[model samples]
Each structure stands twice: as structure tokens, then as C-alpha cells.
Target: MNTAPHSLRPLGCLKAGLRQARQQRALLCRQMATTTSSTISSSSQTAPDHGFYKITDPKTQRLRSAFAVYSPSAIATSPSALAPLIQPSTSSNPSGALARLIVSPASPDPLPALHQVQIKRMDPTGARTALFAKTRHAARVGDVLMVTHRRGGEPFAGVCISIRRAGIDTAILLRNHMGKVGVEMWYKIYNKNVAGIEIVKRRAKRARRARLTYMRQAKHDMGSVSDIVFAWKKTRKVMTTRGGGGGGQRLVVVLRRRRRRGSRSREMREGVGERRGRGEGGVDGNRLCSCYLFC
Candidate 1:
């Protein structure tokens, strides 16, 4: 076979090899330029330094020491997430006030927190004393109560006839019999003069109605008041005493002794009689003396 000249070999193969070499060089240059731009951008984005060296860096090894110096709760901006949003309602004692007796911060222990209820009518001349409950839950329907009146020396022992439980204006109806006569007394539960209320017995019956009105017409059952007992707490009185020499203040309580009825009037009568004796000797003087003493 005859050999062809090397220069005269296919001119198309030589042109294709030159074109491929140019394309590889262009791709290499583009990749090098892209990698250089990314490195420069990353180095320029460093964070600014704060003056406090202890908390500034994790590499300093003292960031935890600064955090331990402060209390988390002292700087907190919100209340505890677990606490309830509303307070539960409680029954009020006779002083037209509601108070809770708390024993400690960690544990809230309940105790008897009310005392001494007296009632006054719209007329200034009328006043009465009745038995009072120390707390709302301390008194209930179908209970026997011993009420001591301010005027009468003897106590009125009765069964709770009815109860009107309007918040702040709660009252109880009490019933007792004098021979053949039935007597009923409606007492405001929160009065200040109610000397004391002692729950002698609690009836076994659980009354559905808050008021025990059915007891009024029904015949008496002697067995209803037996075999049940409950303990009661007396209401507390706040008595203030003045400090002597004034270094520190002290609290003192004074117990009130029961007073007899009409003793106050008798004292006023004796004073008026003496005043009349010194002023004149006439019918007008005698009448004035008697009016002040007796009426």
C-alpha cells in the first residue's frame, strides 16, 4: 500500500484537538476565580467585640463563673408559669370582712379566724346579740347552737330553723320553745356583738336545702340531736395597748367580761337622783330623777 504525507493527513483532526485544549484552560481559570472570591467574603464577616471579657468568648473558660453570680428568679420578667390565674372564693365571718389564716409560705394551714358578732337595727335604739360562726364552714344547717344575749343572763339554746346566705349579709333563723310558746330569732351571722356561738351538736341529717325550714312544722325527734359532736373555735378580739417609754412596740389582748343588763341604767339613775337632791325639792325634780333612773 502507498503511505500518505504526514502534513496532508486529515486537517479536521488537527483543528478539533486545538479547540478541546482551549475549552479545558477556560474552565480551570473560572473555578480558580470563584474559590478566591468565596474565601475573601467569609473572612470579612467576623463579629464585633463587646467590652466584657469574661462573657465575650467561650475560649476564655470563665463564662460560667459570671452566670453563677446572679439569681435567675430575681431578674425574671414574668411570674411562675405553673401558678393559677384566679383565687378560689371563701366564706366570710361576721365582721363584714373575709380573711384567711395562713400558717406558712410553703404550706398554707387553715385555722379558725373569726369571732364576736353583734347585730344593730336601722333604729339606733334596737340591738341584739346572737351566736356567730368563726369561719363560713364552721357553721352549717341542722346544728344546735347556744346563743348568749347581751341583755339576758341565760343562754338561748335552739335549733337552726333557717339560713339566708347572701354574701356579706348572711343571717340565720333560730327556734326555741318556752313552755307552749314557740320563739324564733333571726340573727345576722356577721354581727360584732354576738358574744359567742357554741355548736353543742350537729344533726346526722344532711340537709339539701341550705335553710332548714322543714324543722319548723315537723314534730321534734329526740334522737336527731344524739351521737354527733363537733369542735368549735371562739372568735378573736384585737385589743391595742399603748407602749410605755417607747423603745419598741408590743401587742396585747384584753378579754371582754360579760356585763349585766340594766346595770348601766341603774348607774345613770343614781347620778340623776344626786343631781336632783342638790338642785331643788319639788315634783319636777322627783319626776326627772325617776325618768333618768328607770326609763
Candidate 2:
């Protein structure tokens, strides 16, 4: 009973369709507006957050910025922006440079030294005498020294002693113009130019020194018992053998072995030329003699 006419139904359907189309169009318009707003927001710049970047006042008008993000690969960046990122070996570095590595080299110290040394020994005879050093400044063994003596308290000349050793004080000496070393033959001038005992002791005390051997030799004269004896035996031997003309020739050989000192007693002072008795045998300034035994 209430059903519409067939023609009216078609007209209602059309109205309903029109209303749905209007609602769809309105919804589409709202969607387009939202999309446009989103697009604009995405394209524009936003305010920086404290986590992303830092701001700095370089100086007057100069301002700078840097990124705080820590990523291994992110370090390959611009110089000004990346400078603050570098770290130093110590915590004190505010600028953050690599820091210098300083070091030093090594060295050595120093020492002291010496002057001269003697190789051989020389006769102590001339040593005390200033003449000793003067004669042989740098004396070596085998050197010769003139021998002298006193005859009847008179100065006699002789040439004896050849150097054997070279030392600071004592040295080995041979007598008789190149004789072999023997007791009297190898006599040592403990102090050449040797002075009397009293004088030596006095000088030593005056100088407040240990020894006056040097002082004595310097002032006193030198003579040896060996020189006298050697000459003594030589002269006598000449008298007995060559008689008078024997002076020009060297003395006869001395059988330095110990023999009888006198014809009567078996006394002795028989040195090198034991062949004859003590009269003239050694190299002392005065020398031993065979005269008493022979005559």
C-alpha cells in the first residue's frame, strides 16, 4: 500500500547517489590540505638540539660550530669543524694537539794522566851532584862517567864507571874504564860528591828534609876507594912486570879472586885483582894496593 510509484523510485535513487558523491569530495579536500602542510614542514630548517651540534664564539665577529656525534667514519671532515675532536696524550691539553715527544742523547766523563817513567837505572854517584843530572840529563845504562880520586890528599883524575842500570836513585856501575861489575869493581856512590857524615846530617836537618844525599853531592867532592886501589895495583903490577915504561900500557890482568893479603899473614882485601894483595885493587877513589904484599 505504501510503495512509491516506479518513476518516483528512480528519482529518490538519484538523490541518494548525489549525497554520497558530495561527502567523498569533501573528505578528499581535507586529505589534500594535510598532505600540503606535511610537505612544507619537511622542507624547512628546524632549531638545532644540544645533542647534535655545539656553538662557539671564536672571537669578535667570528662564530663557529661543530658536530658532537661520535662515529668512526665521521672523522673525515673539514679542518675547522673537526679540529676540536682531536685528543692529546694528557688531560691538560685544552687545544688538543698530538703533544711533543722530547728526548736526549748520552755522553761520557773524563780522566787524569801522568808524565815520565824511567826505563833503566843510573849511578847514584853523580846523582847528588848537580853535575850528575847535568852530565846525564836522560841517562841510560851503559853510559860512561869520569872517575876521579884524591892522591895524598891531592885531587887526581880518572875515568871510571859505565852505566849498567837506570833508576831514580841507585844504578849499577862498572869501574876501570869499562870493567866488569864487582864489589869494589861495582861500587855505588851512595851519594856522589859525597860529603862527610856530619855535614850531610846537618844539611838534612837544616832543610827539614828526609835526606841530604842530594845536597852533599851538589857541594862535596866525589872519590871512591875502588879507584885508588885499581890504580894502585895497576902501578905496582907495571913496576914488577914492565918495570918503569909500564905506565903507557894498561895494567896487567887482576886475578880478582881472593888470595893472600900479605906474604907473612893470610890477610886479604884482595878484590878483582886477587892476583895481588890489597895495595891497588878496586875502583874506590883511593883504591887498594899490592905494594905492601909485594915489597
Candidate 3:
């Protein structure tokens, strides 16, 4: 027996032994280099094929996916990493780095935000009064509206009262067809019986005051008989009181009121020959007169 170490015990044996030891060391080094830890780590985590989660690195520049999931712990470490890419996540957001690392981002979504709504059929003829009810019969402030009233088969026109937003439906003020501007009226969705409940295309926002515009235009275009007497009264009040004007404005107002009212009071009594159901006209008529007087 030779007194050599086991590796060098024999020429063939020693060579084989040394080669085996060398190979084992190389294998151990390779294994160490590939491992995330001292032990083998699983590759079944959320991440892109490139191995990064949340696409923080984004392998390349364009948006990676619709959304990236992240780990809260790992995410906190690189809190500002996503700032340039998208809107800042809220403090309550759970998206983070590790979460991204664990799961692949989702595909980008293409969704529309708002859609147009349509009114299929509304008693178009009665739209004026209906619109008035909706607008609370406010003044025709900004622009004028155009309407088409069908007297027999021919269409006519006029201006409108104010238009306001009432819940989802738009409310508008319309001068009564009876030539009483003080008789502004309204029509709810359910009550469109004038001609037919057919809503024409929505108005192009020519003026911010769609209601008033429509009222003004409708009288001309639709040829609806207008009751702008109340409107005139209201305008005269503002011009007389708010700004510097001649006493003539007051005289004009009083004289105009006396002439119109004196003649109108008799007309009103004759026109409203019978009082409508208490709640239906009493309260509303009062409101109409008040709007004519003040607002």
C-alpha cells in the first residue's frame, strides 16, 4: 500500500478522484450563481417572461400591459418607480413591486367613458310646454331657440324660456301658445301630447342659454303664438331698478303695466273662465306671475 492521499492512491484512481472533485466544485458554483437564496427558490411567481413583476423595468419603453400587480412590501421599496408611467396610485392602493414580480400585468383594456343617450319619441308638439316645466320657466337670457309648431300641416316657430338641468332630463320654459308670456309652461317625460312625443336632435350649444334660445327661435320658426307680456314686465323691472336709467323707464313700466294689465286683467278673467284643479294651476300660476314680476 502506498502512503499517498486517497486522491493520489493510484495513477488511474488519483486522476479520476481529482477530476470528480473538480467537477463537483464547478457544479456547486453554477448552482449558487443561479439561486436567489442558499436554497432552491420556486420560479412560479407573477412576473413577465423577462422575470420582472409589475413591469417596473418594462423590459422596453411602451406600456407593458393594462395593469401591473405589485407586492406591498417590495412596492414600498420603489414607491416612485411608477410615477412617470401612470397616474399616481392612491395611498390605499395595494399594487406594488413584489405583487408585479409575482403576477404578470393584465392586458390593456379599451373602454368608452360616456355614451350618447337618445330620446326616441316624445310628443314633439307639446315639447315647448314640457320643456318649460323642466326649465322652471326661467327667463330667455342668452341665446334664442328655434321651434317648429304644426298648425294643421304647416310648421311655425318661436323663442323659448330658460332651460335647466333637472335630474337627467333637461327642463325648459316655454311661452304659452295662448300669447301669455306669463303663462310659461312645462311638460314632464310622461306628458307629451301636443302633436307627438318626438324629440328632434338635441340642440347644438350655439349659446349657453339653450332654453332661452330655443324659446326665441321657436316662436319664429314654429310660429307658436307667444305670451311674452310677462317677459317684458320682468325686463322692465330689471332695467328700471338695477342700473341708472331715466324715470322714463319707471313711467314706461307703470304705463305699460297699466295698459297691459288693465286690458289683461279682463282677458285673464275671461281666459281662465274656470279655475283649474287647485294644485295644478293655482300654485303654478302664482309661480308664473312671480317669475314674471321678479325673476
Candidate 4:
């Protein structure tokens, strides 16, 4: 009975040792898992610095810090990797590095940016804005306007009937009379072919509507404005001359000679010998006569 108890004591000691070994192994595995998870979380929270950093050597115990130089092949192959390293542009000039990058030769699509630049160049003075503004001085419907074409043609003077406010494509409709016939035309305000626009006359009274399409009818029609245009031109003929006495300026009457409409025989007779001599008609027969009036 003594020998049997001693043999069972050895078996119990072996079972306790096995349980302790299993518990130690589980604790070691849990510690390793926690260490790995902490490393992963720290790496994810911190952002990598693309700038210079110090590198410490384990063997020599030396520290080195310098700018990192990348090869052209690496830059070409992995542009996204190096994108964060490039700094944003700070210059205000249009010919700066960023501007050159956007307008680079490598770009296949640059028409949209180029078109916006062209639109800005087309209206540099903001004259189109003033002409279509809602202010008291701005042009309105029923106001007489004269538009001159760069390409040779008679200037068109008409009343503004409608205005379309489309960006880069703004246009105005004008109606006028020619030889007892009503004529209407559309003029693009920012067109390259339009030389200039002049306000010939303002409306005596404001119109009741935005568009004056009712003026097209015979009953509401405004007759030919040619007489008013001629009167305006006559008023613009007064000239100013500076005096040498006190540096004061005086108004002068500029008399313009009118060509006589007569028979061919009469024109031939007047051109024969009368034009060669500077008689009472002045130095050049067609020269303007200035009559100075002291102010």
C-alpha cells in the first residue's frame, strides 16, 4: 500500500507541471499579440515626413542628415509617391512655374483655359458692362445708338430694341428706318469686327417695358432719326484754341466748305484756273477757316 501511494504522487506532480506550462505559453502568446497591435496602431497614427531626417548608424554611432535625392527614373515611374514632396506655388505672376505647368506642351487638352484668356482680352475696358448695366447712366431700350463696323460700311444708327446678356456672346437688337422702310439688325457687343459704339441720343422718357418691340408697329413707330444725328454732329464742331497771352483758351468757329452740286460744265470751268490761284477762298480752297472768339 505504501508503494502504490508513492507511484500516484509522481503522476499528480506531472499533471500540475503540464497545466503550469500551458498557462505560461498562453500568457507569452497574448503579450506578443498586444505588442504587434500597438506597433501597427502607432505606425498608422503618425504621418511620414518627406523632408530631411537624421539617420543613426548602429555600428559607427554616427548621425547623418541631408536632402534626399531621387533618380529621374523613380520620379517618372512613381509620380504619386513624390507628389507630396512638391510645394505649392507662391508667385502671383502668370508666367510662374505653376502657370507654365498648366500650359505645358505635354498637356493634350488646353483649349478651355485658352478660351477663357481670349474672352478676357476681348473686353478689357468693361465697356460692355457699362452699356448693359441698370444704372441711370447706362444705355436702355429706346435709346439711339450708333455702331461702327471695322470692316468698311456705313455706320448704323438705331434705337435699342432688345439686349441679350450672355457672357462672351452678349448682343443687342437695333431698329432703324431707311428710305421709308423699317430695318432691324443684331450687333454682338464684343465681336472683333465691331469697331466702336456711340450713344447718339437718350430717351426723352423711360419706356414701360424691357423690350421695345411694340415700337415696330406703324402707329407706335419713331420716325427717321437722321435729322437728330445731323444736329448732334453740328453741335460737336466747336473747337478750342489756346492763347499765348495768358495761357487762356478760346472757342473758335470752324467753317467747313461745302462742295457745290452743279452741272459738269460748271465743275470743269471752276476747276480749270480758279483752283490754281489762292484767291479770297484762302490758302487751300478746301481748308477750314478758324474764327477765334476770346472767352
Answer with 1 or 4, whichever has the higher lDDT.
4
lDDT of 1 at 199: 60
lDDT (tens digit, per residue) of candidate 1 on 204-294 = 5556777666666746533233222212211111111212343123321111111233457566445444533543453343211110000
Per-model lDDT:
0.41, 0.31, 0.37, 0.58
Q: lDDT tens digits, residues 110-224, model 4?
A: 5656655666788677666566668766777888877788886998888899888766677888888999999998998778787777667778778888889998999988878
Displacement of residue 61 (Cα, Å) in model 4 is: 46
| Best by the lDDT measure | 4
What does candidate 2's lDDT look like per residue over 49-109, in tens digits? 2323445444632223362222222222544333333332253342222231111112122
Q: How accurate is candidate 3 locally (lDDT)?
A: 0.37
lDDT of 3 at 72: 30
For residue 197, give model 4's deviation from the true position in Å.
0.9
Ten-residue region with minimum lDDT total, candidate 3: 110-119
Q: Which stretches of candidate 1 lie over 4 Å from their true place?
A: 1-137, 218-295
Quote the RMSD, in angstroms, for model 1. Answer: 29.1
lDDT of 2 at 158: 28
| Model 4 score (lDDT) | 0.58
Instruction: Tell how far residue 257 is off in model 2, in angstroms.
Output: 55
Question: How high a TM-score does candidate 1 get?
Answer: 0.30
Which parts of model 2 have CA positions greater than 4 angstroms off?
1-144, 148-169, 177-184, 192-295
